[model samples]
Target: MSDIRINISNKTYVLAHDTEQFHHAIADLDFTVHPQQFVCLVGPSGCGKTTLLNMIAGLDPHFEGQINIGQATQSPTIGYVFQNPRLLPWLTVRQNIEIVFDDKPPTSLIDNLLDNMQLFDAQHQYPERLSLGMQRRVSISRAFAINPDILLMDEPFVSLDAPTARQVRRLLYSLWQKRPHTVLFVTHDLREAIALADRLIFLSPSPMRIVSDIEVPIAREQRTDEGCVEAFREQLLQNHPKISELL
Candidate 1:
């Protein structure tokens, strides 16, 4: 795993029948993510957050830019966790995770992941039988199972209830601690970003461009404390009044 370099001059989409009508999703967006660094892309809804992730993940190649993962000739492995747990409904929890592997997966690693995520017992259950939180856990487990160089997550905790989201967040942090992969997580929620990211990259509304990149000073362990998180947020807003407007 190495640094991720991205430079996008412009990313446009056709809006209507008229050739002149176009929507610029991103413009002049340039940034680099250090290896094993956790950075959150924070912005208002529809601010091209997902589009940027798509480009980085190589899911969309129509944009005008260069996205290079590492120095190697072969592209690095990428793990993506979408907004929803797109698990196979018919497969059991364990099977869903195993399918990501082309050949036989390391049983020890799979078992460790299952034990850590508390999915060991539920591994036999189908997606429908599990709660939304459990399903998301499976999605996360599957992503990490690949041991990818980069991990891209898109609001994996958006629709969960408060407590469940908190639990999932904790579990994610724990997993990252064990094997810290380069992470680019997308979310509109500033507080959530503050809690999980080592740095926060704020973007403008549509035709999104970099507005601010603030390094988080609070220790990751201290972020769980709401008071500490709130204080950092307040201080950040005070330092950069412009960022508050986007949120």
Candidate 2:
């Protein structure tokens, strides 16, 4: 499937303890994600960005909406990377990754992925022994093991130090270069979204609705250098000063 269509008419929740209170998380939001497109959803903390991603992955199906995985008959396979590296402490890194696949993938395939993720040296190590950055790498590796049609990342780089986050972001880009998937990434950082996304979508406060959808015309290669990244940052802010309101 090359395109994913999402339409949400309404999504609401009620506080169980208080029957009179009702909360709406999303409303009348619709968007399409093209193949290999990296789309970032940015909003304040309670804007339901992660809630929307969860709906797309079928992890939470209570929302009133439609998520079509293009032409696929069965539900499209989805890979998800949560904010935390939820790795199994008892398993080796390689084993943790392998567990996702129904059948064994070629040894070379796993090896190549681990090597590219810089986890080949740490593959035998348990999650508890690895640094947080390494643990996140292994988490990413496990997600890719299934070759998902769409990958959902919910604040995957949150809580990392700047240097570690930069390393992991580069590793993510390298992996995506090898095999690009339709990606939906949720982040609160405006600059981070600007740096990583092919398309940047800004969301309003709760009862989340898209405020603006902007495309990044600059190629990823151009943004690789530190100079280019800052240049692009200036370009975005200058062109769309409204983005600053959220920041």
Candidate 3:
């Protein structure tokens, strides 16, 4: 198995304004993420789940520790999908996705993504013309256009309505299955975590620490079935009661 061992030892962070009041965002977080594995980070609000993700993305350099991708060194090619779509209003759907590709991707690849995302008909539509869910779909397509080795997503489906969110989740899982990159997804939604992750990492309240690292035994292909999804949901609630309350 291709595994990325992450050993974050004795790492602590303090607010920029309050140096003396140290907040232990991540305290001795030691875990390994297998390559092509889908991992989820779950915790209460302000528990520093996103902070830990930022550290992995190499956006925050102040923390003291090491985050090894596969070897001892770090991996620079990382793609991020934030809570908001963050698409350019002036650009059309095709243009937005094409932006990630410096040169054009093969016409077939672009068309395939657009069709899979259900955005093919809206290719010429600008962000302002599409609904919020459509815009987010475009954002997701754009993120994958670069084909980064690692993908970091922070609650990409949190704001959507239930039906739309579920649809997007299925799309995301399909995409991840096809191109298995090292994905670290952060979310408070237990169902979302269970539906997409190969392993689930739970964090404690503020000054987060690794409370649990549970493997999701269900096969990726089986996740779309209603029975499998419901079972996973029940298991998540039973296993992580504290984390459930945060959602």
Candidate 4:
């Protein structure tokens, strides 16, 4: 197994704005994400969760720290799925997903993802032609099509209705099972975190230091139902008392 260690040590950030606020976004944070591990970042709003994620994605270079993946000096290939679907209105579902492929991806791979996302029937449909949930599914497909080593998801299901969100969550979990990747998911939803994470990292508000790093005890293969999800949710709540008040 490839050992994937995502190290963020003594990382501090000071805003460039007039305030010049001194914030240690991730203070002396050290966590090793083994290959194919699913990790989730859970915290209150404005907890610098996204800031930490951005640093890992190499989107914010002004921070004081080092983020290493394996032994390579260069950053790993990343695929990001944001809160909004962010699909192109001009393109069909197939075209949108295909755009992510730098070189031509295997047709079978694309087809399989479309089927898994329940987007096979809507392959020729434009973004406007699809519903919000469908568009999000397309976005998920697009992200996975790139075959990234690290997948960064920032509240990808936050905009959907409860039922739709649950469905998408299942789809995402299934895809992760098929093609295991180093995933770093950021969400305020405790249920979502418990349902998908192999390990959970809880951050404090403001400066956003790592408050808790927990290994979820549930087995991934059995986490396919709401009962199993709720069980883990309760476990998380029990472990982190602060999360209950925030949620």
Candidate 5:
């Protein structure tokens, strides 16, 4: 797959009641993510992170500039994991993932995805029957099952308890290692961003813009070590004091 290029000059949302009023969401933001790279967009809440992801995903298009995924001759598959686990209550875990494909996908594919997410035993259970963590795993499994060229995750683990969130993060990293896809994950948590991203893109408050683009120095394996990540974070803030205030 080709790299994902994003260039945004301006993006504004009109207020529902007032046509004259506009909410400036993003401006003068530009970045390109290489294929199979994991990048994190770190910003304060309501800093237009989700809006940018929506624009890239083609969910919202009324914005200036463009987002190109892969090559023009190829159709890039895009997968999204939103803030919540948006699963169909009626569908079992396996069925939820199966529904993404236009045709019936191979049973082996479904089994393997469930197995990887550690949900094989619960594959037959409905969304309502599973815990929040389990449901989130199903969501992640479904996203990867599509074998997306670009994966956009918007704080998928935000609502989980700390322990559960850590578990999910490790699971996501394991999955990404097995099948590396171009990923742009958005989150406000600096520690989470440090733990997952290969590169970190810090954004200004809305109308959002890029403030800093940094390559994560800690190795992927070392990220799981809390002391390493924490030390790096402390040094990072000490070096870039401005970024400290942005978050």
Candidate 6:
């Protein structure tokens, strides 16, 4: 388990470098993600959720404050799942997954992931031939194969149908349990946030800042069922009025 600490005074991107005009993206954001914790960042579109994730992943270094991930050193091992399954169309499903690794991971790990993700049958198939859901599954398998210490996901289920999203959520839960990592998942949907997060952090629109930090006590399984979902929704609406407004 690795602890994380983040303190961002501001996130600014120059819109017109020559004119020195900039867009203030995020401001005064402070938070922490405990080792192996599943934390969700929820806000309206264009908020700094993805910006923050990118900073943590070390993609954008032009931020104001400090982000101290556990064991501050060289780069940390990170797994990223984007809104789309960014698989290599030319590669076979198995090859697409293995390409991410610099050193070869054990055969058992690869076999287990392929078996668990139900991609064994499609391992030799190219990404273009598989259904969207199957391709996303392969993408997920690829992420886990790297054995990441921190996993960053940006609206991973965005374009999927409701049923497909639910199915993926279940598979995600199973995968997380198998190898728990410090996960920072971003989404604009509050309902989806409730379903996946052990801790919820809500952000305001850009320039963004933390508005609410909540610990979700509801069990993951309970949060997904129909009756329990409504109950959880009502509880959130009562307790966090701001969250409802954004939703």
Which candidate has the highest TM-score of all?
5
Model 6 spans > 4 angstroms off: 17-19, 73-75
Against the correct fold, how does model 2 do in TM-score?
Answer: 0.94
| Native-referenced Cα lDDT, model 5 | 0.92
Q: Write the per-residue lDDT of candidate 1 for residues 61-157, one digit (tens) a residue.
A: 9999888888968679999999999999999999999999999988999999998898999989999999999999999999999998999999999
lDDT of 4 by residue, 1-247 (tens): 3455555555566667678777666666666777788999888887777877787777887655566776665556788887888998998999999997678767998999999989999999999999898988998898899888888898888878999998989999988888989899999888888889988888777565677888888777767677988987887688778767554
For residues 148-201, write the lDDT of model 3, one tens digit per residue: 788899888987998998899898878777776889999988777877888888
Off by over 4 Å in 4: 1-24, 73-75
Candidate 2, which ten residues in sequence have the lowest lDDT sum?
222-231
Listed in order, each prediction's TM-score against the native is 0.96, 0.94, 0.88, 0.89, 0.97, 0.94
As for model 4, its CA RMSD to the true structure in angstroms is: 2.4
- Per-residue lDDT, model 1, residue 32, is 96
Show model 1 residue runs off by greater than 4 Å: 16-20
Clashing pairs in 2: none
Task: Point out the higher-scoring one by lDDT: 5 or 6.
Answer: 5
lDDT of 6 by residue, 68-173 (tens): 9877564678999887899998999989998987787577888899888878888899988998888888888888888898999988888889898888877888
Q: What's the lDDT for all of these models?
A: 0.92, 0.86, 0.80, 0.81, 0.92, 0.85
> Deviation in angstroms for 225 in model 5?
0.5
